[model samples]
Target: MSDAAVTADLETYLSERVRSTPPSGIRRFFEIAATMDDVISLGIGEPDFVTPQPAVQAGIDALNDGQTSYTANAGRADLRTAISEELSSRYGVSYDAEDEILSTVGVSEAMQLTMLSVLDPGDEILIPEPCFVSYAPTARFAEANVVHVPTSVENNFQVTAETLESYITPNTKALFLGYPNNPTGAVLRRDTLEDIAALVQEHDLLVISDEIYDRLVYGEAHERGHVCVPSIDGLRERTILLGGFSKGYAMTGWRIGYACAPAPILRGLYKVHQYMIMSAPTVSQIAAHTAITECQDEVETMRQAYDERRRVLVDGLNEAGLPTFEPEGAFYCFPDIRSTGLTSEEFVQQLLEEEHVACVPGDAFGPSGAGYVRCSYATGLDDVKEAVRRIQRFAAKHQNG
Candidate 1:
């Protein structure tokens, strides 16, 4: 066959879902920023801290001890035990390490595994947006129809029980929750979580709670902080809990995370996980175990830094006329630029061109994100301050003209 025929044949063989999912809108700006040296980039959600010394030393120690082989398909028992223990103490959720936990590449893989394992073709999953960019796409990739429950900044971008109820249909099989949510950094309060937990019982819905930023949750004493969804009454049995070392531990590149579920649900996830990823890296598993056991202080230290930067940046944006809501968790500040009369993309692009500052367009998360842009405070404090200053100047010139 000719070249065109061969290409067409391959395309025909590929699934439509695979072809239709768009590339990450986050990385597109990164590519543009890569070509410039002067850009103050707040586009990515990566921590500025180095990996904790104990974790780094643990990996180095493992390498020195020649620990470079593939672990069990379910990952190292000790690491799983550590995870299980931590979850038990921290969230009041219990699981047997051997049968109920499976370590994956990261929460990224955990999410995909959960969606694929639970979602039959034609089943529906409700996703709250603007959330992490992956949730909607991963569900679609699993051949599930993704129904978006749009949450607005007016409501603090939280999914209320009423909002979730409105989206449910007979085919809806699960709900995806990402608290201390990305972009908006909106953490659901306890009452709100109880509301969602009630829905889970009412509908018998499966849930995938991505709590990667659980450890990073911070707010005033008056406001309730991150509530682990599985710890809620009537939710643990059906929820597939996803978490990782990436954000809280400053180990993004290590690519290590884990999932926990009831034994039956875990069995389904393992079938997808085993064939796709035999095991997570031995070094990372060792490192994560050490960190979880020994590095609580280091995690708190990093959280303190993010909290300080979050305060300064959010306040600066609000004073700059951008109207940024204080993000109670995570490292991002989603500032409303609608008052400037610019779409998210237009604001992001022109700011990059004019001020050489790079923040992601909030619309990258979903259509509801159009009037905002997500500025990550994960960069250094100096850079965060300077970026806010530049943004203020930019906003003045564009002041709804």
Candidate 2:
């Protein structure tokens, strides 16, 4: 058929929900940074380290032994068992491997499936502002509305019970909690989590706690371990916990993660998983199982390195006259750029072009991030130092200008 004839007969069809979804702000920055040379990039949230040796070997062994076929929709029995045991031993939260956990392609897929399974059109989910970008869009994709609860830097970006209470609506179905968060790298202290837990319990809202960065904590002694909201009173039944091997074990390419929730939610999530992805890769599951069960020491070593990098980056930013908040977890330093009198996007762009340093704009996370920028310290210490120097030079030049 001729082009005009073909085009005239049919209008392009697309789902209204899909058509309305916004592109990921984080990814857009990454694409822009990719074209530049000599750029010291702090844009992405990935770990700089390679996957731990043990996990890599386990994956190799699985493939060599012909473990390539698909596994159960809920994931392999051994992997789920390992995950359940690890969660119980590490966090004091009990979940039945058979009925309470489902392995996912990644925490990303788990988030998508959870939203799809729990939310309906017009329902609302509460997300704290400057959160990981995926939460709002994922909720939107599931035909749910997102209510952003802003958390400020003065409070160390912690989401308090009062803030959560104020955002609750009649249609609110869940709250997205990301501790050791992206961009800001802020974590919720135990007492704060306890209060928030109590508030969620009172309101009868479900909690989708995104604890993917739980193992990346890098601060005081008491802040290192993951704190499950379920550990608090009455939260276990109402909370769906998300975790992954990507950040903790440097297994990003493996694409293996799991969700722990009530049995009913798990069932719904599994149904969605079955249709969307029959199972996470079988070899990756085996590798993840081994990593969680036996790779604690390796994970700790990486965490220590990240801790040093975090300190270096945060200190350097402060020294360079950029007001920065110390991150309790995750290998990122989000510094306020308001002093520069430039919007976050402009600040990042100028830094990348002039200083050959790449970092994401804070506004990409949410509206509250307008005057800030996120710098990832997940690279080598040398790279972090160099990036800081470039930033300092850029700041000095701009100040003089």
Q: Pick the candidate with the highest TM-score.
A: 1
Across 1-43, the per-residue lDDT of candidate 1 in tens digits comes to 9999999888877778988988999998889888987899999
Q: List the residue pairs that clash in candidate 1.
A: none
The local lDDT score (0 to 100) that residue 167 gets in candidate 1 is 93
- Clashing residue pairs in candidate 2 are none
C-alpha lDDT (0 to 100) for residue 308 of candidate 1:
87
lDDT for every model?
A: 0.91, 0.88
| Deviating ranges (above 4 Å) for candidate 1 | 1-13, 221-223
On lDDT, the candidate that comes out on top is: 1
